[model samples]
Target: MLTRLDLMAGAFRAGAALALSEPEIRGLGRLVRQGDVCFDIGAAYGMYTYPLAALVGPGGQVHSFEPLPNPFRLLAAGRRASGAERIRVNNAALGPAPGRELMTLPYRFGLPIHGWAHLRTGQRRPGRPISFSSTRTLKVEVRGVDEYCEDHGIDRVAFMKVDVEGFEARVLEGAARTIDSHRPSLLLEIEDRHLDKYGMTSADLADPLRERGYLMYAWHRGRWARVNSVTTARRNYLFAAQGGL
Candidate 1:
């Protein structure tokens, strides 16, 4: 007999499988390896965590960070259900330093709020505030990747996936040392509205990686789409350090 949560988890997994094309999944699979150290920043409900854990195998390790209470609990539950020893769950938001910050979650599934606020074109409204969860500011711990790896004795990080709402720039700033030292591949989400909220643009995100000798390519329609900063929303960009070790 399975619990309702288990059923929901199963449904979520199934939906993800159906939603994501095979090539996209394969591309994500290719970014990691056995015994490698991977980071899933802003891991919402373990959508990528579980699959990544399995991809990395028992020898590799995954550190998933999520700050929101609801999603954090879901990530913990997913980790437990996965029974994968290599996945370590952390409840925190990664930024340039360790401190407290406020995060605004969506009131509805597709209703964008905060910096990333934008109307979901072609999507029907789910309803009013009653149909959506209330928005609140919660204090969350923020840390740099370099500090985290140094303290944990993780010498090399193979891949880092970041989806920190509108704070991607800050998150990247905090991981400068780590990026310089480990030269890990990065999978970053970039939304124009979100960047605008922080007074940044897609160019700001791409310029740094380009300066560091990283090659940028977008994930789109089940394949890697070579593109520039102007057209990033089709999918997240993948940055691999030139001559990565």
Candidate 2:
């Protein structure tokens, strides 16, 4: 009975509500408390950073990362505006090794793309239908999670969100020591299309987490629910360690 306009308006309202209170905060609010530490890889423009800072309070620390130069600048600006001294912003990408890479930044309709920028790891093939109209490149620093955390004296992590497009496996591999030691709950984005660019499958993501004693969860039917496996249909997933949430 709903027209297209009505449907769009409903979707907009839903997004507006989500913007006000992120589902991550609502779902994992109990898990992460005041004074806890958090990480936001692929933080983009601080959409999650600011809200996360609110939940953690001034006592907690939120270390956020953005690889793209433009987004990193914007994220850093938001960090400054927040004046939350504990919220640390890093303009580097976390990967298997600490190095530098020429990451490809895509632009659609003459605007810098927000969600689909990826590391130029291999022979740059024409992305399936090439979502962006044009592209630019930037050399960005890459750090390993365990190394970074150790160097920065970060001994505990209550939560982490990893949304580096299809580079989930590499990120996880780099953070294996950190995950094993801290056992923080993880929110990640891993899509087949993104993985396909690197010749990876969803199982490449799932099996590792399972081996490390993690169960996958997806936000389903308006609530957090367990999922048996990661699939292309569901890109964003929550991984809880040391039992269910």
Candidate 3:
């Protein structure tokens, strides 16, 4: 009863689900129950959102924010196909505060390609002119984690995943209140090269979380690695709040 295209789509979805459902990643999902809320920043194609929605079940909610149009469309389509009604999709970028800013794209991929000018050194591919496109950027509301919880009546957050390109610092800044209050475990992506473009170093990215009582661990070789030096090209670091204060 299924066409070839249907079978292919099913296979693709299955593979995607597996890649995003790794143990370390699913650990966050397991933290969310039937009524908790989770936020997914830069949710490219809802790779993690669908599984998260399943973890949260019918009662919990997942708010996914994507700034770029290409991936945002795919995220929305995936949510629909998965019947993830508890997931709310927002088409805007989150920053330190709420304001419209220029977002640059040099690559077709969903991740941050070329926003930081300093990191632009020698990375540009030859013979490819940087493409410039602008959308009506919206200053979506910004809230610290604590404030967001207070506003939404969220007493506790099971998990928070942040992957805001080169703007992870700003995202963390805005969520300081939440981090300080609820102490929700955080899964963040850190790229040294990307941060270097904004005059930021790896310490600048990790230090704050350390100060906030979060322990840093990297994902590598199908497990969480405690040392960042052990990570590979596909590895990402996870920060777990040690003690809620």
Candidate 4:
């Protein structure tokens, strides 16, 4: 009884809701325990934040960062509505330093794709000239992880989920001290196409994480398989410390 247009609209409407994949939810459950300190970097709309808050329970806390104004509003509202008191929402971008930076936002039908917004960095220029008719840009506040953690007196971070699109390296660079101190397990999203937009290669991603003593793995088939390098083939990666969680 539904037309193609109707179905398409329905899908978009459904996407507006905050939800997480079963595998990621399972992974979080396995990695997080109650009372743990966790972070949701690039948390779009509380998809992972809600679940992480629930997993951490009353004693634990989950700090969620979302830069885009639109999504940040939604995330904050969701946090209040969910009544997940353990989740803290921050409305600033995380990078290697504290300042302001430009962010590129891809659009569709003149509307921004909230989940695809990414920070722009000077480290690498796009390999090829890239442009989209619907694309637009904005400036966002950027904060360093080390400074934020130190200022907040948060010394322990049990788990982190980073989906900064292609700026993962920058985010990690800012968090080096925190990474060194906490050695928290991370769920990172690495896509070659996205990285290429910034003239960066997948190696740029694997190198820093490796330097921090993280071994990458992909949840392939039914098991966690070791990944030696970042290829165009894979996206979501789970990085664990050598010692274990």
Model 2, position 114, has a per-residue lDDT of: 63
lDDT of 4: 0.78
Q: Per-residue lDDT for 55 in model 2?
A: 65
Q: List the residue pairs that clash in candidate 1.
A: 35-60
TM-score of 2: 0.86
TM-score per prediction, in order, is: 0.80, 0.86, 0.72, 0.85
Q: Which stretches of candidate 3 lie over 4 Å from their true place?
A: 1-31, 107-151, 228-235, 243-245
Over the stretch 84-174, how does candidate 2's per-residue lDDT look in tens digits? 7878999999888799987878899999876878887642454546767898988999999999988999999888899887888888888
Off by over 4 Å in 1: 1-17, 20-23, 106-134, 243-245
Instruction: List pairs with backbone clashes in candidate 3.
Output: 145-178, 146-178
Q: List the residue pairs that clash in candidate 4.
A: none
Q: How accurate locally, in lDDT, is each candidate? A: 0.71, 0.78, 0.61, 0.78
For every model shown, the clashing-pair count is 1, 0, 2, 0
Candidates in order: C-alpha RMSD to true structure: 6.8, 6.7, 6.6, 6.6
Q: Give the per-residue lDDT of model 3 (tens digit) for 12-115.
A: 44664477333455344334566777888777776567666766767888888877667788878877766667888877666665545555455334344423
> Which parts of model 4 have CA positions greater than 4 angstroms off?
1-22, 127-131
Please write out the lDDT profile of model 1 over residues 121-199, one tens digit for every residue.
Answer: 1123322223445554456777789889888999989999888755777888889888988899998887665666566
With a 3 Å backbone cut-off (N, CA, C), the pairs that clash in candidate 2 are none
